[model samples]
Target chain A: MQNLVDHTVEINKLLARYGVKFGIYKNQEFHEQLFPFDAIPRVITHEEYSELEKGLIQRVDALNAFLKDIYSEKKIVKDNVVPEDFIFASSGYLPQCEGIIPPKGIYSHISGIDLVQAKDKSWYILEDNLRIPSGASYPLIARELCRRAAPGTFKENNVVDNRNYHKLLKETMDYVNCGGISVIMTPGRYNAAYFEHSYLAERSGCVLAMYNDLFVEKNQLFYRDYKGENKKVGVIYRRISDEFLDPMSFNSESVIGVPNLMDVYRAGNVAIVNAPGNGIADDKGIYYFVPKMIKYYLNEEPILKNAPTYLPFYEEDRKYVLDNLEKLVIKDVAEAGGYGVVFGSDLSKEKLEDMKQLIINESRRFIAQEVIDFLDLDIMENGEPVPRKADLRAFVLSGKETKVWASGLTRFSRNPDSFVVNSSQGGGFKDTWVLSR
Target chain B: MGIISIEKANNLYWLGRYTERVFTTLRKFYRIFDSMIDFDDAEMVYSEYCQRLSIPNIYTSGQQFVDCYIFDPKNPDSLYHNMERAYDNAIVLRDELSSNVVSYIQLALDAIASAKGTAAPLFQLQQVVDYLFAFWGCVDDYVENEECRNIMKTGKYAERIDLYIRLQYHTKDIEKEFTKFVNRMKKTNMHCNLDKLAELTEIINTKKEFNTEYQEALNCLQGIVEVV
Candidate 1:
């Protein structure tokens, strides 16, 4: 472990050499910045991992069930386990995806469930990312480099190897593949997660594609080659959003979308990973009902806890949120990547009043949660160890079965005062080492 | 790896072109830079260098030429710009090239970027050449797709021959590059005008002085492979 800490600089240099970076647009110019890596491992005991594994698998299973029901039967709505307005009014709920069942009936093939440990050692679910969740590649690649830097440390510890993420991802695609080839479709190099898209494609042995490389012909999705020939694509693990997936189907002005692709998908000629309408299941407002969903769909109580969230859409919850505005963290339901998150305690008197008014008017637009004091993790800073705010994104894959990858992406905030640990918000990450014992 | 997309093929081709362009031009600038150090023959050699490459005479003095030609981000014909272009193309092709193979180009780009405004710019720029050499070697050793390799190498040898011709290399030197170019072009699935290729080869291997008819050869080489 000490050896891993000592070789942090060398590992970071290696990461830079491999061009491991994420792109961000500031002032309308795209800049690729290397994702900073912290050397320390976030160690989880074998027994604790067992509990998390059970909880994550149960959580993802319920989410997948909810998506299937929402898109087809509307059973959850009829039963009142989840409300009607939360389903229909969500921007995540695509009317275009109704009644369309993906192959294998799996919506979120790969689920990134954000979790944090409280100082009391209780784990709370922060958010769920079902639509093209990234960050697995960060820990996967970092662990490989860490092992090379400190082989003895790995030998001494019982940490589970996370290099099998690509294999698990491949199996998920293979399980859902209908016929021909598996392709990873990316928007382009300018995308924030382009490096992860390309790296996963390379590791998983899938064809990395852009919209120009793909076309829909004869009610089938095909990848075009340099020779102007087309090869049928059976499964596409697309990294682009649903709106930018098919120009004709969703956003008509999307130049990055493959035109008429949704028609092919609806025809069942190809499989789209995580399916298109998955945003509904991972919507921030939708998150409040997940534990209820687990009981409603799976007939079991949730093993993990939600962060005492309050959906402002409810009159009772809205009144509570308005009164406790200074204590709760407000999240804009529509935004992601650590954006649109406002800490009420950090707001001014005028802004706090404005927020209370806005919540009263557009109650469905936000969800409020009691801010949890995160269990800080130690990271190397200027050659000394210091604790920082961090959260883990545990990847749960629903393929032939739902399983949690032993490793998770642990992102920590560099600023001492901030609790936002997203890579886009200037957070550094560490590898989550789940002990095999 | 078995299938190549149109965008990737174009990027691989341009990546080859841009990298070879930087590697060859930077080496050429080294020779011209050494002559310019004498102070009297500065503008004359750089002027001829610019004319050979067919770029504008944008520099007013030797210092500006050395600075802008090697380091200026604004100069389109500068080594920095071409290296940046190579990076732009290479950055998007990580899956095909593999990150290990792409790292060499990254190393070269990093070298060129840090070499800017340094005390010993030429010495620092030598690492760019060394890294580019490593890039080619790593590609051959690691890349499994023969078509991808051939596509990128076609751009390499084609740009190399084009540069050799414009720089007025001897007919034998030009013929050696032409053979490698023809071999790689034939292996690629890229649609090429073989007649244009034959004419270009004839111009090089007519056992005649290539310097006399290099423009005609350059014209024939332009549309041989539609991408580059």
Candidate 2:
């Protein structure tokens, strides 16, 4: 294990040499920061992995069914499992995609479900990132570096190679490819996950294109080369947000979006990875009903459990949340990336009262969960070991078959007391290794 | 293998031009630096440099010119300014060129930033020159696509010709460099007008006075678009 730590240090240095960095904007200036890697990997046993595989597939399946149902049928809403107001009033529910059925009818094709182990050694779901989840490249590159640094370690231990992430990604894109070339569209290099975008494009054999490089012509997406040759683009794994996907459809003022991409997507001329309008399934309010969705759609009990969540939209749940305001963690449903998450204990008495009143006024906008006593992972701080909050983002890819990448991105909070492990919030990441037994 | 976008191609061509401009000007500045060591009044060389580069002479003193003309990011002809331009061009074109190419330019820019306070400026200047050479070498060895090579060569040759004219190199040297440049362009499949090539040859052979007949040479060059 000590040798493994030494190897990790060497691997991290090599990663820096390769310019493997995540870019962030601070005070309107772009800065590239190294994502810290921990020697300690989250090892999953084969039995555990098999169980997780089943759970993840079921979870994503339900999420995809939920998205399709919300967009088209409204059966889930009419059945009163999820409230109509929650579907209609939620910011993530895109009305533009009311009747649009994506290619192969799959939404949340690549779902990044955030999970954290409890102190009791049981896993609990944190949040679902159905839209443009990143961090897959970090572990994929880290594993390569680790293999180079500790060739003997991999030889000795039967660790499953996580390098197949790119292959899996390519297969997933190809499986859903409408007709032409696969393109990984980026907003630009200044984006937070630009490194992942470009690296994945290179590894997956997909052309990395920006908005200017791609355009809609004759209701088909095409990538324009420097020589002005337009190659038809079939599958586009765009890293941009849904609102910024097409200026004509969503944010009319957005210059980073293609002019008529949504029209093409509507025309079923191209396949979008994870599809558009997947945010409806990932909304914090919707997250509370995922376990129920698994039972409803898959007709099986959820293997993994969601953190005991309460949507304030329900009169009963709202009363419970208001009563236990100080014990619960209240989250604003529309916000993500560790934002709008407030620990009830962190607030003063006056603030708690204010929050209670706000939740009462805007009941549909908030969801509360009992803070799980999650296990803390030990990471090196200065020279000594310090316990820090860490969360795992397991990537689940659904194509012809649902598959979960063996490796995951384990993000840890740099601040000892902080629970937020988002890269935007001064957190670092470690490569997760699912051990083969 | 080549990830050439229209924006990236434009950036790469300009990057090649700016990097060459900095390298050639830095070498010329060394000569001015040698003259300044002996003479007290060194403002003439700085003014001449500014005039030759077709830039405004804003500096009132030798130190000011060194600060503004060599290191200022605001000055369009400054080494610091050109490096910034080179970085901007190289950053977007990383998918096309070798990754090392971008890193070398970044290292040179970093050296420039740190050397701003150093007493001996040539120490840093030498590093920049070495890095620029390595950048081109890396591009040649690592960049596999012929179109990318052609675009880079076009910028390199165009900038070299401009520099040769400004520095007033011998006609034989100019002819040799221009011929190599034209041959490289031809090898890389860049279309150039045969008439412009003939006119360039004539000008080099005749040693035509540039001040009086430079406009005619410029017009002849304008007729040939370096197909990127």
Candidate 3:
């Protein structure tokens, strides 16, 4: 541990040399900044990881079943387990993807489940990112560099190698691949997660393609080469959102989209990893019912717990939320990346009254939850250990069966007073060490 | 490996061009810097360099030229700008060239950023040249695709020839660099203007110096790549 702490600056220099950065758009200008790395690892004991492994697998499996059901039979809505308004009214819910089934009936091939451990060591799920979740490459490269910087740390500790993420990601892509080569499509190098897009493609041996390099011909996607030869693309792990995926189908002004891509995907000629319309399953308003979804789909109790969430659309919950607006954390269902989240205690009396009225006026657009007193992890700052709020984004990949990558991206707030740990919001990440023993 | 997209091919070719431009131009700047210490008209060397590259003379003096031409982020024709362009292409070609080889470009760019306003700017800038050398070495050792490497070298040799002729290098040096350029151009599937190549070859064979037809030779070299 001492050796690892001593080599933090050395590892950071290597990260910069490798260009492990993310792009951010502030004031309508693009800037590339490094996703800082902390040497104090978020270590999980084998016993704890085993439990987390089961819970994450079960939760992601239930979410997948929910996505499949929502797009097909509408069983959950008809059975009255999930409200129909929440499924159909979301901006994430796309009507264009109503009838088209993804290859292998798999909607989310990669799921990033964000969780936080409370002060008592109990873990709670904060959110589920089914569409396009990044940050796996951050820790994967960090662990590789860390092993070189402090070889004695791993030799002295029982750390599981987290480098097999690319291998597992490749297997997941290959499992649902139709026939031809796999491609990881990106908007451009200016996009936020471009480093991960190119890095994963290189590591997994998939071709990294831009929209201009791809075209739809005869309802099949083909990658065009300089020699004018076309290679069929069987599976595309696209990094763009669904609304910007096929310009002809969703957003006409989207220049980054491949024209008629949805036509090819709808024809069943190709597979799109984490298929379109997955927002129906991961909507924050629907998060209040994931426990019920676990029981409804898997016929088992949920292994993981949702951070006690409340939907204001319910009359009883609305009254309770109105009465307790000063204690709960209200989240806007339409926002992400640590935005649209406000703790009730942080608001003044007048603002709290305004929030209460906003909740009363727009009942379906908000979900309030009790603030989880999550435990803080110690990180090295100016050669001193200080506790900061942290969270784990555990990646669950579903190929033949759901499997959790033994490692996760443990992001923490660099600011000592903040709870938001998003990289865009000035957060740094640490290597998650899942023990082997 | 030969099957690359036209966009990627363009990036690879220009990546070679820009990286070589920074390298040779920096070496030339170092020589000019030494000459500036000995001569009264120190800034004349920069004006001559600007004329050679066909760019406008924007610097007021020799020291300003050294700072802006090498380190200024705003100068479009600066070495820093060319290095950034090299990185823009290299960042997307991770699969064609391994990450181990691509990282040297990143290191070189970072070296340029760190050298800004340093106490000993020459020492810091020298590290940029060293990293560029290391980048080329890593490309040779780590890049497995031969055609890709050749395409990059085609751009490299072509730019070297252009710079050499414009700076009135020896006819023998021009012939040596043009031969190397033709060796690479013959391997790629990209179309080159054979007429321009023939005219340049004739000029190298007959003319003793670039004192008469310098601009004409530069134009022929520029016409080698069909810029569609």
Candidate 4:
């Protein structure tokens, strides 16, 4: 571990050489910043990983099933297991995706399940990213560089090689491929996760395509080459948001979208990975019902536990949330990337009262969760080891079969006092090592 | 390598042009830097260099030229600006040209970024030239697509010829670069203004010295790519 720690600077330089960066808009100006990497890996024992693997696979399967049911039968909502208002009121629920099922009925081919281990040693899922979740490439490349930096350390540790993420991704794309070439469609270079979009495309051996490079003809998606050649697109791992995916179908003003893409998708001629309208399942408000969804859809007890969440839309939960306003963390259901999150403890008396009034006025817009006293991981700070808040985003790939990648991205907050560990909020990441033994 | 978009084709061509522009101009700057230390009217070399490239002589002194032309991110004609443009084009070509090959451009850009106002600016700036050479070498060796490599090289060689003729290199050197440009242009399926290439070639073939028809030569080279 010390050997790995000693090579942090060199590893970071390699990361920069490979252009491991995320862009952020600050004061209306774009600033591209490197996502700092720490050498100390978040090591998980094989037994622990085995448990996590089962939980992640189970959770992702349930999420996929819920998506299928919501768009088709709505059995859960009709049976009063999950309220109809939760599904209809969600900004993620797209009426355009109704009655049309994706190829293989897989809604989220790649699910990034964010989890944190509590002080009690039990793991709790904080959120589910059914949409375009990134950060997989960070640890994927870091593990590559780490192995090169300390080859002996890996051999000594009996760590499973996490370098096969690209292979896993390729397999997922291939599983749902209707017939032609698989392409990873990106908005453009200005997107925050452009590096990952391009990197994953390169590593997965898929054509990295932008909106202009693709077009729809005769209800089929085609990738246009400069030489006037065109190839049919089978599966598109679109990295753009759902609303901006098809200008003709969803957002008429979106210049980044392919016109009539949804028409092709509706015709069953192409597959969109992590099918559109997935926001309905991964919504923060929907997060509270996932455990119930696991039982309702899979008929199996949820292997993972949700971080004690309270949906404020409920009269009882709203009363509880309002009474305990100063002890909980309030999250706007529609917000992501650590935005629209307010910690009650960090709020002033006036601010807390203002938040309570806002919650009362718009209860459906918020879900509050109990702050889990998550265990902190050690990182080298100023040549000394110190503990920092961290969380793991375990990737669950649903192809022919759902499988959890052996490794995950473990992001840690750089600020000593902050608990937010998103790269957009200026956090560093470490490679997660799932031990073989 | 798989399917190049028209936008990507343009980016590849400009990537080639900008990288070469930086490489050749940095070598020129080094020579100018040397002359600036020993001669009084040495700063005039920048004005001459700018005039040849058709960029405005916006600097007040030799030091200001070095700062603005080499480091200022605001000046669109600066070396830093060219490197930024090179990266913008290279960023989109990661799939066409492998990441291993594209990384050298990133390294060169980083070199320039860190070299600003340093004690050893010359040493740091020289590394930028080294990285560009390495980048071209990587492109030739690692880029598996022949058409992609040719398109980029056509942009590269065309830019080099323009700079060489503008800076008044020997006729033999100009002929050598023009030959390379024509060779790459012939390999690419992309449309190039053959008239421009032929006129440039004719000018090179007929003239003993480029001093007389330098502007015409520059005009022909600039028009080589019919589409921007």
DockQ value for model 2:
0.34
The C-alpha stretches of model 3 lying farther than 4 A from their native spots are B1-3
Instruction: For all candidates in order, state the fraction of native interface contacts they contain.
Output: 0.77, 0.23, 0.61, 0.66
lDDT of 2: 0.82
| DockQ of every candidate structure | 0.82, 0.34, 0.69, 0.73
Provide the overall lDDT of each model, using Cα atoms, as 2-decimal numbers.
0.92, 0.82, 0.90, 0.91
Per-model TM values vs. the true structure: 0.98, 0.90, 0.98, 0.98
lDDT of 2 by residue, A1-437 (tens): 55666766677766665567788878989998888777766677777777877888889988988998988888888888887887887788899988989888887778999999899978899999999999999889888877777777788877889999989999888888899889888888788888788778767768878898888989999987766677898999999998999999999999999999989989999999878888888989889988888888788999999999998888999999999999999999978889999999999999999999999999988999999987998887666678999999999998888899998999999998899999888898887877788
Model 3 clashing-pair count: 0
Best-performing candidate as measured by lDDT: 1
iRMS of each prediction = 0.8, 2.8, 1.5, 1.2
Model 4 bad stretches (over 4 Å):
none
Rank list by DockQ: 1, 4, 3, 2
Error of 1 at A49 (Å): 0.8
Residue pairs with clashing backbones, model 1: none
lDDT order, best first, reads 1, 4, 3, 2
Q: What is the TM-score of chain B in candidate 1?
A: 0.96
Would candidate 3 be rated incorrect, acceptable, medium or high by CAPRI criteria? Answer: medium
Every prediction: chain A TM-score: 0.99, 0.98, 0.99, 0.99
Q: Is candidate 1 or candidate 4 better by DockQ?
A: 1
